[model samples]
Target: MCANKKANDDSLIVAIRDLNTHGQGVGVIENDPSGDCQGMICFVDGALPGERISGTLRERKRNYLIVTLDQVLEPSLDRIDSDCRYFPECGSCRLRHLNYPAELAVKEKHVRDLLSRNGLLGHDSPVFKQIMGMKDPLHYRGKSIFPVTSDPAGSGLLIGQYRYGSHDLVDLHDCHIQSRPALALVNRIRELASRDQVTAYDERTHDGTLRHLLIRTGFSSQEIMVVFVVNDRQADEAITSWLPLLKDTIKPLGFALQSSWINDMDTRGNRILSSKYRHLDGSQTIEEIINGVTYRISPDSFFQVNPRQAAVLFDEVIRAAELQPGERVLDLYSGVGAISLQFASAGKELVPPLEVTGVDRVKQAVMDARANAKINELVNLSFIEADATEWLKDYEDNAENQPFDIIVVDPPRKGLDPKALDVLRESGTPEIIYVSCNPATLARDLALLSDVYGIESVQPIDMFPRTTHVETVVLMSRNG
Candidate 1:
């Protein structure tokens, strides 16, 4: 009887056949002999399609569920060795083990499936073109932010990523995702911390000096910015002495200090202790060239992580806008004026008289956008920093700006706020280009807007190649 019971329990094995939008493996139950007749949906971790694994029953809010892959039974052909040393440990990437070409196919299919489900396009509707592959997938990341930890077992500090899904720090001497220069800097920092005896801040104990190390690099210009985050502003003579050595070794554009104070046991309320930073060579900025146009980037400014793919994404947006030379355009959520600058640069050649207004919530981004306008000497371009929803409300109320020819919106992953969508509908912008990173939220928002606006087309661009994430640009027009 005991052996029979064990066999029945073991018979609950399920085969994972697909991946869900959130990167979870999904599978369906094969039979229902008792006629219970309900399809099974399992959320399996670290399991891919064509893999069969036993699952344990789990209780969700109102439903009983089964998740698989406690141990791998059968592996898929697409699975390959992950290049990153931290692969399974780091939760940031899950599909890294999958072949690169297969990964891109999955991303493309995911986007198409999302749009089709929302009735924005038919399954037979043209597949959005696959974004061209990157010149260098490995070491393409130009920025890395690592948390620092004071090793209780060791004398000095360690800087790296947090352990898989936990707050515990994992010391990384080399990260394959980041640029070669960034890896060198990380190694150098670890060496200097040991030599200077600079203690890393411990979040658990709420003690020590260093908290994080932020490194940003402009690959084209080879400009680097190193910002050290500390818990307090105590002047460590050893660390201060090595500042020259750090500069000499890295040749960074800026070295900044971010100091904070931890008050509560939670460590969430830590306040910035220092607000100043020193610029190397009297410059605290880096330059990135996109599509033959150069733009300056500051520490706080926002720019796309993948520069080459960003250009392709922006090109799709511009094409969908069907921009005419003399048309007036409004760009919302314009980070550092990338889209606006592109339009402004081509204003005279495409349209005899073109005007572009860029709006963003970040003051620094607005300032950078305006600065770029000045540098390019684009007279018809302007930038504003304000709550986007509030600005839309005001624009709706005003008679003059009621019907803009074209409006491009690149909201954050959360998608447009409810109020903003309402205002956008009322404003009656003739054309809108909605760029989104999250498909689930994008589908939800598209459903809301579909009542008033007609989706013309959706173009999905693969920004992060080795992952399931995709950047989608959708074009819509008011329903006539």
Candidate 2:
């Protein structure tokens, strides 16, 4: 409708060419009235490659235009009727509009292009394995953080996802991608709030009580953890008197409440959990077993959201590590020692066993890692609280500590810091197993390590199906 606006140059008709890193369709429009539209590349949401579509311009910057697909005259074979009630509106599943196969292909290209553009995939592109996806992709998310907002119609609290780029909540009772228990628990939480008149926070006025409902579920155990993120710690009568009502209501659903907590957060910045928290009922930690190692997951712990895909991702990591007995392995940014403990457990079959040391900046995670190691009775694994980069440099100087034969680094999306990459590069470690969530950052870090290590294999695991995000594991071997 706004295409005819003087700023938009009417509209641009372009063939959907490829998908960008964010899963948005990329296309180019040749010389046009808009100053930036001359040979300008365009990205349109919900438009697939090979499909000719008319896109109306929304915003233009430098050499690109953010266009809204006006009409998909020719749709791709991959397009399907989305079963989600809130597809395209809800930001959780960016690729659900595409067929399952197309979603996987988009993620595969995202990883490969990031690597190729950064020079990791040189002359000989390694025979990369096909993307591993879920058999039943829907309702696979084990954890969900649903935003609470005042209903637009002005009746009760509206709880659902925030729109893709804004804080506006798309009122929804259930999500298509939440675990069965998660969606059910959401309904129950909304009911409890309405019945007890729990105040939903408003960002504009900085008022109200409840901010969000944070729920985490154990895939195999079927246990549940619920946390109420409130705007402030000022005691709310609804929370004090109504939590027991909530616990009593959901008990018969076959989902055991392993943990329940109240976390006070800021209305601004859209924070999830704050430092101030109190236990409502149940234990402070929930449990999940991965590869025979039981992890006591705390409320704030950074556990993988998808346990099923997690199992697959971890298996790939273990296979890529190729650890042997008597080897010294260092696990960097090892939250809860999942990777470190898994390696140590696998080494048990080998007579010598691996000497594994895990390091993390968070003392709480290190404590949980120690607890996990004890629970699994893995004697070979040890956890230390320290900054990974500084620790490596220290070990390099201190002869007693010595150098690790192998290293496993599972860094956050920001990837390795430059200083960390420097230490990692000069360490001369024989083998390094890198597990990353963001391909762009992974490629950036790999570029730094390319001189000393050669990327042997690259495996992209579809950890979050229907979403743009992907997890990758790479085996980097020292070059002779």
Candidate 1 is scored at a TM of 0.86
Q: What tens-digit string does per-residue lDDT give for candidate 1 at 1-480?
A: 011122245444667778876566777644333323235665776777787765554432234244535566678888898878877776556787788777777777777777779676786675455545555667666556777777768767767777655877777776656666666777787888787677777655777777776676666666666666666555345555655665666555343222111211214444422344433332666677776567787766678876667778777877787778679888888879998998777664664667888988888899999887787777888898987788878887987754678888888889998988898888777888898998778888888888788887777787776667888888888999
lDDT of 1: 0.70
Rate residue 144 of model 1 by lDDT: 68
- Residue 274 lDDT, candidate 2, scale 0-100: 81
Residue-by-residue lDDT tens digits, candidate 2, 183-244: 77777777777776777888889988888888888877768888889887654666666666
CA lDDT of every candidate:
0.70, 0.82
Report the C-alpha displacement of residue 51, candidate 1, in angstroms: 2.4
Instruction: Give each model a TM-score.
Output: 0.86, 0.94
